[model samples]
Target: MSTALVLTHSVTAAEPSADGAPFGLAWGPITKVPRPFKAEHEANLTALFYPHGWDPANGPATAEVILVICRDEGLQQVVWVGLPMSGEALARTRRAIHAEGVRRYGEPGVGGTADSEVWPGGRALLASREAADGNRELVMTAVGPGYAACSETHHAETGHPAGTHMADLIGTGSP
Candidate 1:
């Protein structure tokens, strides 16, 4: 129903990446209006852990109105756009997002979680079922004050791994 959600679905499925630069360099300008959540993060109005995100200088997104791209160690993973609904509304917001993820992606992947502990935000390259006929779709993860979020698409195949990889990569480690 939400355009940004739809965009997230499409973008994650596409798995945008870069050879030697940030994807935003080609995603066009910061002129395009972002979704409410993205706009909030851009203004630092959300619980976003900054320095992980950046707005496009100028092409056209066709991906995310706002995104967090990390090119450290020359390891560029898929470019995914996420929104954090922290504070009092986090749980409810994550539920809505998780429902939406299932609606678009069918079922959760092998290591996916459809429970209350973790909330869906956005994901990609996911499996629908467990068998060989399983589907590779999208998913989302919730983020908050002590808890940071990462694209669950990465963990879908490996089950729930402990520790915070995003934190280590972003220097927000030790959380």
Candidate 2:
């Protein structure tokens, strides 16, 4: 696999939720700070992707909402991408994502396949893998609006591993 450019930023505009959650709504633009992925980072990505199987919530034990935007070939492919806090959160976000899938692709199940007609401005596509392996990487690629890609890496040993690394490359921004 090619080494991807990892970027991160602290979202300061939004306040914590009413319940005092660690997550806040990210507005404006995410700062692009390029950094190499370390072993710890990989472990974290595993947890996020497969939280149910991970023994203890190693991180904050809080649900963080992330919006992943991707673009390719000068076209905007996806938007408002919300990652669930845990495996249970997956069920909740799944429905909403399915709805969006239908709206964009005219179909609900877009798993493990390349979808060229999913988004309005999206072109050239690839879907996430079906196998739930921690080491397995889930990614989608498109080329049109601009070169963009979203990658999710699971843990290799444990069945339940929070995604340690989730990265997106959209337009000129990196996160």
Candidate 3:
């Protein structure tokens, strides 16, 4: 994602900058999203998606894109799931995208697992990961004040294992 894309898609000039919120959705309130999105409630978390399709980003087409919001705490993360791929193509795409993330956010303060790269920031995080089935994804999570609490709540209610949610990386000193 280019800096131009980030600037053009951002919420409003008056709102606090959504440096970590992809597509320019800021980190507060469901109503503030500019695009019409459908919300799916799961435990205390809400997964919001644009049913009518969103404006395309510059790279490979996304099969799915979700913005996760913790109950009442507002937007928490943006997940962009690229279409499934296999073999060398998958590796190449993942590498290219991961490199782009590094260029945009600098070296990650933490995270260099075999299948993923994570960059932690003061208020959010940027990460790229390749799933076992070869699906690649980019995750941008808000890690500010209430994130830890939100992570705890989601884990408790959903029974998701630790580190299952990208936002769980917060407070792990891994960004």
Q: Cα RMSD (Å) per model? A: 14.5, 13.1, 7.8
Order the numbered candidates by lDDT, best leading: 3, 1, 2
Query: Which ranges of candidate 1 are over 4 A from the true structure?
Result: 1-88, 109-175
Give the per-residue lDDT digits (tens) of candidate 1, residues 78-136: 22233332344434433454454465445554332332222133233221111123422
Q: Please identify model 2 stretches exceeding 4 Å from their true place.
A: 1-84, 108-110, 113-175
**Candidate 2: 10-residue stretch with minimal lDDT:** 5-14
TM-score of each candidate structure, all chains considered together: 0.26, 0.27, 0.59
User: Once model 2 is optimally superposed onto the true structure by TM-score, how far is the C-alpha of residue 105 displaced, in angstroms?
Assistant: 2.3
Name the candidate that leads on lDDT.
Answer: 3
lDDT of each: 0.28, 0.25, 0.48
Please tell me which predicted candidate would have the highest TM-score against the true structure.
3
On the 0 to 100 scale, the lDDT of residue 160 in model 1 is 35
Per residue, candidate 3 scores C-alpha lDDT tens digits across 1-175 of: 1000011111121122445455655665667654434556667676656422454222334444555667867876555545456668656655665565566556766554444456645443444445567554443343434556776786788676223544332223222
**TM-score of model 3 (CA atoms):** 0.59
